[model samples]
Target: MPDNKTGPFLQGITRLLTDGTLGTTDIVESMHHRIVHPPLLPSTPIQHLITGIAGITYRNIKWSTRLIGKGIDKSLYKLAPFLGEIKDTPKKVALVSILNGILGDYLEINNNPLAIQMNLKNQDRDTSIDASSQACELRNVKGRILIMVHGSCGNDFQWNQEDHNHGIALAEKFDKTALFLNYNSGCHVSSNGKDLNKLLERLIYIWPVPVEEITIISHSMGGLVTRSAYHYGRLNDNGWIKHCSKMVFLGTPHHGAPLERIGNYLDTILHVIPYTTPISKLGKIRSAGITDLRYGHVVEEDWKDRDRFELSGDQRNIVPLPDGVECFAIAGITGKTSDKPSIRKSGDKMVSLNSALGIHKDPEKSLEFKKKNTWISEETTHSELLSNKYVFNKLASWMK
Candidate 1:
């Protein structure tokens, strides 16, 4: 039998409730322990049981908060004109707090869950691909292999949409094969990148036929993963670079997203509360999602011109880039200003025009690719940039 923490935990809770041994501090301490020491088997039966119990607790708190937010949103939407009529800090704070609550709810609930699981399959099946002689049957007959890496909180299905998922479109356009690289966004950047590089090395070596080319189109944090994978591939002399012919970045924060810093502030404040541990995990700067957005943890001297943010390796170009690879970037500009309307003007609320297009050389600027190699679209949001019609065409054009 498994060493069951949940079994004991549940029994303890029952006993505490019956004997009145459980106090708020005791409950809080138990929860804190569980949160800090996440189970090794997230999906194990015991873990699932514990998670279900926790989920119920979460629902109670979340529902109350959500209802309050709904009420506040209704009030705010109705009080649009009243903002000018009343000049009070308390009101302003209340309105701001309401807006924040609503935004948080929308972000959490509106995300595409189908896209989250599109590439997830039996991990065992993936590992066994190497053992089978027929592992790469599709690649052997195909002329090229297209690997797709998705952005933050995105999945392969995000690329499956006819309008936005570029990898599927490219496969049909080129009659080539494709593979979706799926990974958790919560780990460390270098760790995930190294794993991707290793996977790529295995795929290429087992490929049954000559791979004419290997092309990648990455969005947001995916771009950073691409770079990190390339860096590790070269650093380890993994030879995965030999298969890569082209790469494209869409709305990638080559430097870093200012909003993330803002999020860090918000997360810091939220973390002080005992109820916010799950939400707080999303903002750790060292998380793979965050690190990729910031590139590396440390900035390198050489990258100072291209990327202004200081990551651990931001100043060092120590990571070797793929040889003879074509790199292109497409930036988004919703509008010109930082005002709400500016989001409509140049950037995808999350990323700005200058940052998207690699226009500013101050922080590290993007490499100057040939006109045919680069694509810029200011009309799309960061999320929408990946599937823009013109952007897809540009990616296809480059491959040709």
Candidate 2:
């Protein structure tokens, strides 16, 4: 075998191109079919012939594309080992991460190489916790561990935005081991949550030192993943969950993000229309993870047996915060003060303040975090939460 470490990730582009071509052909052919046989219109033999010919041409194109895609895929694999393991640049990582966040579920279903596998970030590349050769990541490792989870389209490296990383800073300050989880954010939070639970189980079993405490600091969609993981931990009776002591959420959209709702609206509108219906495929391109954010779904019960794209109101059974864990929330706002909680635009541009704080109008849906445990940061954007000194201070204080 050759040293083709990059093959696992870069090969995804071939599959992506093939899929894109097929999908584009589908949309175009659908429009052609609709035009030739308009809704509620009579059909003719000429139209049938035209449509059949078009269909055959499209099928041939798709078949050829698939064949070529497979050929390139095999070639890349054979050629990869000789290329050696080309270290992934930050730019490439960001591109791949963003791609996964948008079409992760699709990539996963299709077995595309681009789909990011959930793993613990150790040194340069990610390594599974249960590997025989444990990662010598830290010295004098303690039971106090901090798990960092980044949001949609984000990777563990993103936690260190602009040369400062909350996970590293907190670990240094508190003398604990900080482990960053890198996962495909486009998968359903429930799936990622379950995976994280399993990873933690293995981590605890293989830890160099006895596990005593675990802290999770999450941002954006990452918070939802963390919440789901805790629920699974308890549901499966995973013993490692007992060590989870504190969870800090930064700009997490506990209720739902307005942007995804808007995207849902667009998908709905396009789908309902006749001409634009086919184009709605672009809207439906959103991953299951993004749709789960339609209502901050954190479990299988929340989305199973339902069309995720349907404009269903929040019918999900309200899940309260995980019990026995001191949960702290930090809602960043673009405004100077958080006096206007009801204002739609006061949130950190991505998450509304009320949603970030888990303040649903329905009493049953509210998470019930104490006032002292939550902080509202002003003049901050969602992306700024990672490196913001104030946010880090609040997280450190909560841990203390």
Candidate 3:
């Protein structure tokens, strides 16, 4: 039998090799087409020969890796019975979290073990926060619950940065139950949102005591997922929605992240150049989830039947903050003490100030957040927002 510990590693490597080989083939073929077809650039006979050879080599590698991958998969299956008993280490979980952020939808479709499943976890113990196991799972149940949602390529445990966990600290100070959500960051925001809605319903029903309030604190893409859940919960009339009292978005790209927009721009530019058009496909290789960030998509209608990486304008259906729930947004800037307008505009090096604060040129599309509800933190990067003292103080003030 294959070593259960090594099975996941081998399987993951095999999948990567297989996907890489196939991607290389596609890129080569695209290049070949562009070189030989309409709007083709002038090429010498030597260039034609080199392209031909490259295509053949790509195909050879594709077939070779696929065969090897199949063999590795077979070995993994033989050891599958024992795989269930093996617990994933923190490092493994972290790696999978990154993979999920990159190719999560593909992993799910392929039923890859690397795919992360959404679950509420007990931060004190490495266990699922199950309603049936509330007695042991939740040692202290409070009327007010605080849920922490991590960003793309993140897990619940990683919420603790710089030796401080905002969730735990806030929960302790406020006497609220703190739960962290672990989920595949690569899946569409709406998909995770719907799942979250159902999970909350179960949580509310099985709480040890009557639940009084629910407050969600989400960072980065996690914030989008929270909004999506709220939208769906309202539509389904889920009881959990009624208990939701507040939501705090830390560096959330309410309008969308600027980096994704830049990526989309590069992809469009590459496609326009015939010589480099094949390389453009690499830009499209990002998962549906990443592409969704281009417009902070929060519903199935926003992406269903559409090519996620297509060069198009913001097609996202504007999803305003849920009614009756107090919403707060935090924007972070990298500079320590810069008065330059550019420094403030370049928010957190990932999201823009306008997007994070839900400021839009169009009034109808802009989210109506009260001035007091929004914050801007200078000398803080996007990730630093997770543990910054100033941000923490603001969160505590809002919760209070």
Candidate 4:
């Protein structure tokens, strides 16, 4: 649901604009300084004059933006109640989800109302707001439960694309309840994982029926979150894990995504030059969740006390498929089965085959799924996996 205080979104934008203005001023001043005094030269007195003036100007701009932002917040708060129910339309949800995926931690730290709070929903209705209310909503719920977890920058509704929804379809066919995990994809995956553990615990407690079996079908980053949730659930002895029977991962980067690695590379390369150093900050603007994808990080220990933007190699802790659970993985390729090594390596044009299959050069790092449990889809893109009939067929076979 869209927050009644839609003003924070405007405030967020205003704050970003203010930040951009200040950042631009600094970059321009730095360029001027570099031009005035080349790399090897000593600091000139002219440099100090330019630096001091820019500093004072930026300070005033900062002060002014702060005042303006406060005023906007006050006005928006006063006017929010009259705006009626701000609908979470598809387009609006997409834009906001994308924003959160890019600046989620930033939004949370700054208390931006646009930040998404994780929730579980059934048929577009929330189920975790309270136990009694959830019981009423899920009065006819079944014992078998199938949870659908969507990828980054995605909402649970995106699963219902092309007039087809795998979650609803599977639930209907198998006579089970379907729940969707909707969450901010920009926060640390571990934090979301822990939250998911608590959510599952509460969900089952308030469920109208005793959950006989729990199965999760996750995509991309959602897979990492599922794995992390299970890890925490096991450590905390959460009852939800005992009911978990199976997990199906669709195009999950169990190892890491090459795109984020490339982003990290660019961030590092640009940071080397004075002219482009400021530009490097733009690369670093991606969310903490994105940085986690660089190595499929899913635990706090993996990212704690570390500079996420540093051009670091894969230093992620090895997390394997959970024990006593049937784990399955699926990778999609945009080409035929007979495609070249390059095509195979570029699985789905987003995640690679090896990463999706949890295949690592180091044996210990590999997730070691049963060979028969993995499936590869040909001539398919990452987004198409959601609606692909062939993919659904394979998933159905596994579900059966």
Candidate 5:
């Protein structure tokens, strides 16, 4: 699916040479950002879509999961020692909102505004032009845009430009428009999906000229948001899905993260103590930390349509790709080795090969890749999948 244009190819190759080497600090910065900013609850978009309100609702429920066991209260106190390790989530959310708001307002159209009117009317004619002519016309066509959706606790800045992350490399290689998706990771996946749908609707409606294509590359929980946007967010309502020719997911837990379950279990153990004053009235399941820890929210039975998805058995699957979209996924794994480099060996401290691949209690219901989209690299930790050269190149090849 690589673009037929040479301009993008030259631009990409030029950037690769100019950027030179990647830095370790840059890699750490990317990881640091993911540890802090979780996305908003998925319900955030539901409210907006159904009720036309932008606010979130909370219902406080005691952490009853802890009350089921004996002597667990004393054990819970032991975990108190670990509570200090939880990062400053609130500040992270604030920073993410600020950063994304800035990008959406600034980079989206600030430098190269779209044309006054853009639609599919003359696309066939436009496609007939030569490469140079097409390049010249594209200069006036507003750059090709890639909308990136970050995983839970992720920010737009998480993909460091200097690093090997997929978004950065794809942006560099394509020389198209690139916009990072930043949202409250604490929100529910479905909510964010709906919000994204709305956001896309607004973007196209207001685009300077007719948009030809849009690519969405997401990581971890971000993939769920992307799916939810498609399934429930009404993205196809306005030809949005048609515009999205490519979708790439990097280590996205299609089934949900196993680490989240562990954290939720531990949190339940901590909530039993009567002395532990709850910081917010939000329900235990609804809290930002616990929600991600628990994966997607359990809704009505109809919502758990198992037949709707495909699994990889271990991080691979022929995802229920939206109609008309070319979808693929990249998963990170820690190679079995004694001398592996630091970045290559670790699967982002949080996500592991098992979880990244969506291997869960029900292996039968996991996502299976129709074909190996491409194994980017086993060296990078989970978070580094997007930056890895192998993955990015394969993706760039697909995009073209």
Candidate 6:
């Protein structure tokens, strides 16, 4: 028999399929409309007939699938109450994390089971941030705290990939208590940031010992979330901000990811062609989190009430590093060296070197990262930065 968690996962999948089908139908219908009435380009009579039939077929299939999916979801919900509880395996956690990264905002709005809640874990168990619980569960609690935040389509457990957990390694080497954050990556960066701001405030207040210093090590999208959190925390005068002394951003797309930008461009080009416009809408089907990577939008003002899929130039608000905090950025390059312009432009296969290092053409938009504080590793993948020995040495030196 399947466990309680299985029901929600199944239901979520069903809903996703239903939405996808409906979206496809809408795209086909739009293409048919454009074929019948050409705006910029003309379509043949046969093209019109073909799109019309395809549109009708897609609509019928969409309705049929939606009805069947809803019926199955209801049955699953009924059986969920009687299902046995199951322990979360690493594979299960990873799958849910990917789902959250892709459709996290939808899951959150629908209260789906796959939407991960933000939690602090120690030795694979929730600490609950309660003073007594921390004392009992974290025997090695100390004044110094190291918080590790994972990236897009990832979870806290992923940080321990291939027996290389940076938080554990850093804790062992630096004598600081380490905490891992597991959160829904599909949500807007600002939304997660605001929640993190509150969570950190509560954590600092309930710590077992007097907190002397706090360091955040963030990877990829986690860096944006952390920056957003700090932005809100400072605005609200959160006390935890004072304790945060250092931040290390690993493969962070400080400017934005070029891949997402390319996706946006394709979306525009597809919209211009009436026949392929629906396919263009498919390109826009990526989650809000993925869209945010286009310009590293972190604050509410950056994306509120905006059509995220609209083709637009950089509109991100300038968010400089927090004052009085030592900030370090590390960018990875897959090339043998950074001397090659092409390699530098395609840093780590996901983030560009300039973006990772917070280098901007406009000086006002650039983050003031001192040369001594920034490091670049050639022939290193973005994921490898999490476990690279040289990267570890740099992190250790900064912390010390």
lDDT of each: 0.55, 0.87, 0.85, 0.85, 0.50, 0.84
Give lDDT tens digits, candidate 1, residues 160-222: 554345776677788777677665544434545666777777777767776677887787777
Q: Candidate 6: TM-score?
A: 0.89
Q: Which candidate is the best by TM-score?
A: 2
Q: What TM-score against the true fold does each predicted structure earn?
A: 0.58, 0.94, 0.89, 0.93, 0.54, 0.89
Error of 3 at 354 (Å): 1.5
Mind giving the per-residue lDDT tens digits that candidate 2 earns over 1-400?
Answer: 6455587665789889988998999999999998999888899999999999999999999999989988988998877776667667888889989999999999999999899888886533444453232444455678888888999999977887788888988888998888888899999999999998888887888778888899999999999999999999998999888999999999999999999999999989998888888999888988999998888999899999999999879977777898899999999888877365465355998998888999988999998999999998888899999888998888888888
For candidate 2, report its TM-score.
0.94
Candidate 5 per-residue lDDT over residues 208-307, each given as its tens digit: 5778788888887777778767765343576576687777878876655656566545555544542231311112323231243344431212233432
For model 2, the stretches where C-alpha displacement exceeds 4 angstroms are 123-138, 338-346
Candidate 1 structure lDDT: 0.55
- Over the stretch 1-400, how does candidate 4's per-residue lDDT look in tens digits? 3446455555566666655676666676666666766776687687778777876876787678768766776776776656565466778788878888888888788777778888888875644432223443565789999999888888887898799999999998898889988888999999889988888888888777778999999999999999999999999999999999999999999888999999988988899986677677778778999989999998999999999998888888877789999999999999987978987889999899999999999999999899999999999899899999998998899988
CA RMSD of all predictions: 16.8, 2.1, 3.2, 2.5, 19.6, 3.4
Which is better, 2 or 5, measured by TM-score? Answer: 2
Candidate 5 deviant stretches above 4 angstroms:
1-143, 161-169, 233-236, 271-293, 296-319, 336-348, 358-364, 374-376
How many residue pairs in model 5 have overlapping backbones?
52
TM-score head-to-head 5 vs 6, winner: 6
What's model 6's lDDT at 187?
89
